[model samples]
Target: MGYSRDAWGFDEYHPVAQNGSNLYGKDGIGFMIVDSLDVLIIMGLDEEYKTAREWVANVLDFNQNSYVSLFETTIRVLGGLLSAYHLSGEDHMYLTKATDLADRLLGAFNQSESVFPIKFVNLNSTSRRNYDGSCLADIGTLQLEFKYLSHLTGDPKYWNYVEKIMLRIDELEKFDGLARNYVSVSRATFSGALIGLGALGDSYYEYLLKQYLLTNKTEQMYLRMYNEAITGVKKHLLKRTNSSHLFYLGEFYYYNGGKKTRFVPRMEHLTCFAGALFALGSEKIHDSFSEENLIIGKKLTHTCCEMYFTQATGLAPEYVLYNTNSTGDTLYDNGRKHNVLRPETVESLFLLWRVTGDIQYRQVEFLYLLTFKEWGWRIFQSFENYSRFPEGGYTEIVDVDAIPPKRTDNMPTFWLAETLKYLYLLFEDPDNDLLSLDKYVFNTEAHPLPIFVPSEEIRGEGWNRQ
Candidate 1:
């Protein structure tokens, strides 16, 4: 509640500065509070939830004369509100807030001659223009939230806009089903032939399977695309180091306009999400390829976890470079050495444990089957040891590899929304009682939106049924 008193409703909190600021679009909005609402609800922090709920009901506003990221806002703010609506017993306030926000963002879609959304939208501007081009994930990652909004409101506009992205992107250029990073919104064409699954490209593949899973496994197109992308991932981007045989996700770039291709042996913290994606794909897709998915999932997750352990602070850096290094040494770039409280590795560990039912996966600090609480506790202790502010909340480390790691005042919003929530769910009921994978599909932001059958109206639309 210290935050409630000191920095409530602010977009971000800087622990050392003891101040709050808004950077997403506006000042004094619920960017901090709203993004963390579903976390408050599922953890059964009722008192905290009450405070946040009241803020959303009374003070949260989506209307403003400003531009906000389509991907960031959709995944964090819009996705959080939508998830809160479901988690909070179908509260109308959250639904109402989500509707208003979605409407403000809807202008970004369909204005382009393409189905993909523009990079940003002027929230309250009366005049709309074609926005700058979007990254692949930014354009492709809105499906789960927007489709769920369509389901709740009985309005097809949300679904139509997002669904067109899937439909149109399916018809575009791909390397055995993998898409490049740059998406041209105005022209309906991809901007480049560079595929970096570490960041700009991770969620595009994630949403493919999730869209299939979100619609109750009825969307064959998404399944086909997901399988193809994973196959392409294996064929093109998956690499193992000669040093330790650690599996890592690399990048693919086409230099001569699809005539020549090169592989770059680089991975980032963002690439950790692919571990969970592969795990989910392994379980959901019951075929001969399931074994391959499981193998890659485990190995890739091991590599990602290695990032945390190999560092001095037990926290992973932003990214790393791998090679067919003969000496088995992974080169850590000094420039990219900070640990920013990223949740990708933790998220992957949680889902991997859930998928494999291997208690060892939960026990990251030891070889034994340590209790899940022990795992979360040890991980928490590491953060507290290195990043906790004596005043309140936690700060990020400037460099985890540095002895007595340097501290930064900034705490990114995902620390609450994802890092804490995944840690909680890692051990929450271990029996699949809360936010069970069978029942809920998490958006890329880690907000859990329940899976439901599409309405007959939704089911009959085009190849959504096909």
Candidate 2:
């Protein structure tokens, strides 16, 4: 499939057959390619990395009049550049590009009248798109990237803006320490009481734990909030399959002015990240909750893997619904039946493998790859139905259960940046220790940022004291 763009560079390919006609903006390909740069470097493709780096340094322009998703651009492009810089021996050019991109992104948070950052911003102009408000993930996931940028550039503005968002969120009233998924910046209030470790709220909790690690466990607030949130999650969202006894995190929907809560027995492939994150946090803190957190992490990991195994294609769907009333058999929800080639499950597998050193993780990784390749070959044979064969990357599976499971034309940037890269790192060497948990914290997009240490030691151990 044609992955390269003739005009806008590398943007998402909405298959012509799928009524995807417009490129969001010019120069999106540059953003897409950035996601793969670190993967190339990690794989030791020096020549390819050099070629890509030169292209980015020379041809990539951010001054296009394009309205970009603030969250997507920051995580994929800014996060990618910073990760590449660190992994590629602190390349100055990568840092320069990242700074330029971040400066543009800072415009998203420049709204003085608003309490939260706007979701999208026009790169070439000072125009901001208005939406209801940003989600928890959008506002909270910015800490790792922005904080690391501040450390690198000695500009506190980056960290301050993101930290302010976190503080604002912390001030909100939470249901058992869990905030709603949607919030209104204008009203400074949360909209829905329904909560899940899925799309809108997944990274909020993730950043909480990660921000603590990124700050060298110096900030007691982040740790305190994260611990509270996880405690609430286990109490409210954790559930088990009635028949299989498999543990999965379900969504909690509250009604009647928070007096009643309903459990939605559904899980997203995205929530799988929480498993690895829990395990990583437990390993790092070594507190009283460490052992319990590790157990929860392992259980969640197994449930996520079962999401793949139970499917006809041996690949997990985008989302799975469990029967909450009876035996809790997995039920197919048509809306989310497609597998978008997400990496969260594989990402968790990689992390758990590293954290636990269990050979079973490696075995699961092999099975995932096998399923991916089988689907890849099927799509290649039916090239006309999908796209041209031998494209540089893969696309999403429309229906994992279909006989010749349908394929989507669009290939997401994260496929390169996170999914494939995670798989590569998982098999590179179990003992590589390149991204040791004690030293680096991965952002929501799986970009590894080094843990910060203050020049002068602080007085208290903060959350680590326990």
Best by lDDT: 1
Top candidate (TM-score): 1
For model 2, how does the per-residue alpha-carbon lDDT over 364-392 read when each residue is reduced to its tens digit? 22232333233323322332343222444
| Candidate 2 residue 314 C-alpha distance from true site, Å | 0.9
Per-model tally of clashing residue pairs: 1, 1
**Residue 361: error of model 1 in Å?**
8.8
Candidate 2 TM-score, true structure as reference: 0.88
Local distance difference test, each candidate: 0.82, 0.74
Task: Point out where model 2 deviates above 4 Å.
Answer: 1-8, 13-23, 359-392, 454-466
Cα displacement (angstroms), candidate 1, residue 290, comes to 1.3
Off by over 4 Å in 1: 128-131, 360-378, 459-466
